[model samples]
Target: MRRSMWRVMGLFSKKRQQSPSGSTSGQSCAATSTTSAYELQEKDLGRLHRAAAHGNLAWLRRWHWWLKRVSINRRDKEKRTPLHLACANGHADVVSFLVQENCQLNLTDNFKRSPLMKAVQCQQEKCVAILLEHGADPNLADADGNTALHLAVLSPNTAVAGLLLEHNANIDAQNQEGYTPLNLAVSKHHKEMVEFLQKKGADGHAQDQRERTALMVATFAEDMNAIQLLLWHGADSLIGI
Candidate 1:
């Protein structure tokens, strides 16, 4: 997909360089050179992205001027900003620096995954805390409509889930499949996750697009422990019967 996008841009660049006189012979060479340079620049990571991905705070601070040229929030071809990389890689200090510099907190990547989502998905607890403290939206959904809380339940990280809930993440946020975090936890047989989400007040009775509740999912999976937990928490036992 990335290659195709670059190819299209190259064609457009050539077309744009066509002179009003409709003579492309002279401009052909210049257009080729320009397109190649643009592609190289886009393919290569800027200094800021490199530092953030590697957790090199010293390098970033020292070459801060270069960062200004590239823009602290400059996105790659994938539309992922340096802040996204920092959180995904668990660079708490880098995440802190970027947030303090007033980087956009709620920006989503090509997949619509926010920095907070990446932090939770990657199990970067410190990074998650930093992004949440800096006002990252825990409710932002990805292309699949999975929020940070959704990802947290998939990982079954109670620590991260706790932080998101404390920051007011929507416990019942549903994904594109209409499955809430509790539904996902039960389906994945994440006993601890189901317990944690229930404690946080997730709607155990919440149904998916298929009208299947967490209790139904547990029954389908034949997870006795999950079914026991769900029933203990007042999940309707006969919803899908």
Candidate 2:
């Protein structure tokens, strides 16, 4: 039995080595492996959900007849639909197809995160644009009250941030903790994000649950560039510690 366990472990180790990180192709392979593992472990995930998660467009097409039997908006135990999975895995093609099928654009998962939030969290730029164009509500916060804009800033993806801004995502939308996207960017010492958000008119004076403004958060990090950027954006130095 010990030898059999060792063999099983060795097989997993071999599979892990086959997919190294860094390259885009490698990351896609890793995401596919992760979805496959999830499908194997979770009986709640249906075949269509698994196909969408894996970005298996061909499989989806072949299962067209089966599509009618299953609701496109069907949620698993996690309350995640096929659209959520496709967005989370950065499968732009799958996402486009799902949208074309008229799946609900703003359906939230168990976490209250919409497909747009999932796309931002996964740094899926193309998926983000697609969902936004389909009228996904950018202001919908997750269970933690973090909006798509908040996730985009947290990702520090300038392109995604710009896209969200273009879609009129609430620039000063606060989370459950009262931490706005600008506040988050400043706290994380994301200088370019801070600057970009400021250019987009994010409130530099927005405070968090602790009443700490972006400038105060910048002071805590001792980030000179962030401090200067906030000051340039009119962050009041006297308000926060």
Candidate 3:
């Protein structure tokens, strides 16, 4: 009787193991058809980005539904929709389509950098123009209060700064550290940008909590040109000291 019970228990265990395996496989299969609520991985996302950048209608045709879902999904840690990636890579048509689909206009990444910021940071002038046409805010800042103007200021390109200014970006905007775009130019000793920001209303007198104005910052490594430019721009010699 004991032997007979052992045999019966063995059969039951075997059947239970097989049942669970079959159930799990069916669930996975069901999930695939149930629509992927998951955000694409970086690799998968890269594929979409490449396709959008090229404006390959055929590639888009093959992945349109999936791409659309990604463009609208706000579930990622970065909070970036497909438009953000496309804009960063300068995909004009992709940007237009997403706007038509009503993708979130101001989605920010982990750094509080918006799609518009990405476009500007990468110096994608055409994409920037498209975003502006789609109503992207020229003054949108990162988490640190660094606006698109701030980004342009950080970069060495005066043209990017000029483009942003022409789009009505605030020249006097300060970061969390209170460093205005002019301050950044001075800190980096970017002479042309310093001139441009000053002409565009960048306040050279702006300072951080450490009492460092752009002029004071220019004093860091013996930059006479930046000092002269800041002075020429009306920077107070003792303002931040």
Q: Report the number of the highest-lDDT candidate.
A: 2
Candidate 1 — which pairs collide? Answer: none
Error of 1 at 130 (Å): 0.6
RMSD of 2: 15.9
For all predicted structures, in order, the TM-scores are: 0.79, 0.80, 0.71
Per-residue lDDT tens digits of candidate 1, residues 76-142? 8778888988888889999998887788988888878788888887889999898888788888878
Worst 10 residues of 1 by lDDT: 29-38
Candidate 2, superposed: residue stretches over 4 Å from native: 1-43, 236-241
Question: Model 3, range 32-107, lDDT digits (tens) per residue?
Answer: 1211122335554556555654555477667768866664534244566667777776777777776776777787
TM-score of model 3 relative to the true fold? 0.71
Name the weakest run of 10 consecutive residues (lDDT summed) in model 3: 27-36
- Residue-level lDDT tens digits of model 2 in 124-156: 999999999989989997777778888877777
State each model's CA lDDT, in order: 0.73, 0.74, 0.64
